[model samples]
Target: MHRVLDILATEDGDVSEVVNRFRDIENTALRTAFHNCAVLLRMLEAQAGLTPTWEGGPGAETQQAVASNTKSTDSSPPTKNAPKRRFTPQELQPFVDETQRGKVSVAKVYVDGASRGNPGPAGIGVALFTMDGKKIAQISRAIGTTTNNAAEYTALIEALKLAKDLGIQQLYVLSDSQLMVNQMTGRYKVKHPQIAEFVAQAQELAKQFAKVSFHFIERENNRLADALSTAPIAKIPNQRTDSSSQELMALLDDNPDEGRTE
Candidate 1:
């Protein structure tokens, strides 16, 4: 720590010294490990509202450019209580050293749920990714008859289960279910009894992780997981566990397009 600080404090925080020090780490995997640790440290600091005080810290130029772009685009009158601005990729670049962007251990998961009817056949999907946006693993499974919100929570639960199985400690989850996200974040009340129960289950599962974050993305942005969810339900003959064929599916799946339980 002292050596790193000394390097950063030198020559008005000239990062060339830091680069040179990094180069001294001859082992490639060790270099990536160090870089990943630093990334997590910086995230923890940011969570505590701490910012780098060192002069000429990493990505200062890009950070300024991003900020400038942000200010330039706020020309329109701001709406009242405009939902907290989504943090774009551009805004998060300053935290990562460009050289080590793809090597960081922080991971992300995109999840989605689908139901033909609110209480009709349902499915959950999950797609986990590495820090650099590489898809690592995915899941698409049907979970019988359930409410849409329950399916949403089931998707989250399945994602968490996969992440935990993969030994992931830091996770960022994205879902197209706005109701699920808002309720998980305590922004909305869990009104339905079934949904409330699932919410508790999800929250308890989240506690097993070192960190878990949930965000709401539009359905279009969540195509992969959305497709995964739809697949298990869309193929009725094969996806069904019983000998029930297309005709039985038709009977159970009537008005499957309706009964959207939020």
Candidate 2:
């Protein structure tokens, strides 16, 4: 509602057209807002050199019909105290426009994992960059205390997941973890049982793509991924000081696979 108000206040060539556009909103409180704020919007319109239509403005009859059907007794304006309405798939199409994402079938994924200690607080960062070097999205969050190796594999898993979400087919995964890169590329054997599981999980996700290649990147070149992985550490207290707090902090991000320990 606030965003709509801001848009109405904008000096468009035909501000009334903008006002008429939203009048068809079926949401009671939303439509009510447009009706109650009728005078204010007209004043705004006139202030910008546009003619003000206060009495029986465009869509006034529709607003009157909606207002009479409203069941709420309270006359107070709506507040954003309730959960936001979820958008239907059709409503999401506008956001999928070129401004949000271009035709991106190939992308470079940079992933890095950070841990305060060998088996302390961990976080993973995955940055998706298009072939033209445009960074489209990022994933950054603190994971509960876990080994550095587990976090590295988790980062790769996340990178693949993000790629799949974006419908990316060809992926060039760049990481600063040499051991992880070597293992994923078949240069080194996975001796650690736990890490082997991580490699297995990553391989399964990798199969979803047309091509997924791992490459060793210099730590200097992987600054964005490094920063993303470690960014959560400072936001949460050290595990040694408050393990409970760290656990709570980890809950802030939505994790689909919960209770999966490292």
TM-score of each: 0.54, 0.54
Per-structure clash totals for the candidates:
1, 0
Where model 1 places Cα greater than 4 Å from the true spot, the runs are 1-105, 237-262
Best by lDDT: 2
Give the per-residue lDDT digits (tens) of candidate 2, residues 229-256: 8777756766464466644544421132
For model 2 the local lDDT of residue 37 reads 91
Clashes of 1: 1
- Give the CA lDDT, 0 to 100, for residue 234 in model 1: 76
- Mind giving the per-residue lDDT tens digits that candidate 1 earns over 50-152? 3322211122323433443454434322221133334333322212123433343456778888877555688887777654344567777789876566677
lDDT computed for candidate 1:
0.61
Model 2 C-alpha lDDT versus the unseen true structure:
0.64
User: Model 2 shows how many backbone clashes?
Assistant: 0
